[model samples]
Target: MTAPTPRAILEYGLSSGNVGLVQLLGLCPLLAVSNNAVNALGLGLATVLALTATNTAVAGIRRLTRRDVRIPAFILVIAAVVTSIELAMRAWLPALHAVLGLFIPLIVTNCALMGRAEAFASRHDPARAALDGFATGLGFLWVLLALGAVRELAGEGSLFAGAGHLLGLPGLELVAAGYPGFVPAVLPIGAFLALAGLVALRQGWRLRRAGAGA
Candidate 1:
């Protein structure tokens, strides 16, 4: 099949082709660090940076890469990009970096990033590959942001509790100070439940669209 147009690539990444919601890749970090909005945002930004850089580098060097060594080469490129981002974050945003510690380095192992490098970037030009990476990363970012917001609000009765420190935004508490938070919403089980709901919702929407078109 022919590759999607640039606009389609961007649109799909934001919606139907979301790495988190649709492809369902890289759920370990997605679930682990999304307890709050600030952590989610921090990790999401790092993923975006890593994905974009990896795709660009892979696409730029596709011709020079031997088919047999492509997988390892792609992994090396991804590792280098992730390492650079991780180091930069550690230097500039130590607190946020510390908060997202293991996950930052784990970006190199994210199948979503690897999938894009091998499937799309390897076949496309650098400009298009970069766009795909950005779009794909943005898709993953929004899901993390939404899930984190939901979990935080449900579990802590507030949103962006540490935004002032990590993301430089004012923290907002929607509920009274006395509000008893939902313990389950911030737990590992909660991540599974929340992601299930989102996946279901997406599938439902797809069904509706298919029915309408049919």
Candidate 2:
């Protein structure tokens, strides 16, 4: 494969090698916390923070770690970072943090974070690692936002419900008017169904665009 440029790296993170698309990692939290925009944004930001910190730290210490034990060491760094973020969330954003629940700690297990650390961060400079982390994290964030928007609109007939709390604007519950909510759209199974449909739609669009270009 050709060497990845900075722009290419960013593009890959925003789309192609996205945790949901290329790596297919962290689906559990992706589906679980994506019930609303606020929840999705919170989880997405946490994940980005975890990935960036872990990747940067790993890259900085790459020469110090033995190859055989690198994976464990990486996990240790990730766990510590995730735990720190989890504590911060619990202490400050208790309500939003509660909505995320176990998934916050679960960021440690998210293969996306580890995958980037092992695959990219281990071999790259700190600057490159930071870029990779931001790109990959942003990619994951985009998907979570899309999924959350779909779920929230369909499930609750709203968007960004309870967003003001996160922004420190207390007592704001933004609800759309005259909306018909579909309860199943917010459920676990609904996440799978929606994701599958989106995949299908994306495929169809790709095929149609290819045909037109041809």
lDDT of 1 by residue, 1-214 (tens): 6777999989988997899998899999989988987898889988888888999999999999999999999998998898899888888888888788898998888899999999899999999899999999999999998899989889998887877676566644344488799999999998888889889988999999999999
Residues forming the 10-long window of minimal summed lDDT in candidate 1: 167-176
Which pairs in model 2 have colliding backbones? none
**What's the CA RMSD for each of the models?**
1.7, 2.0
lDDT values of the candidates? Answer: 0.89, 0.86
The clash count of every prediction, one per candidate, is 0, 0
TM-score of 2: 0.92
Q: Please identify model 2 stretches exceeding 4 Å from their true place.
A: 1-3, 166-173, 212-214
Question: Pick by TM-score: which candidate is best?
Answer: 1
lDDT of 2 by residue, 20-74 (tens): 7556689998888888878888999999998888889999999999989998999
Error of 1 at 47 (Å): 0.6
TM for every model, in the order presented, reads: 0.94, 0.92
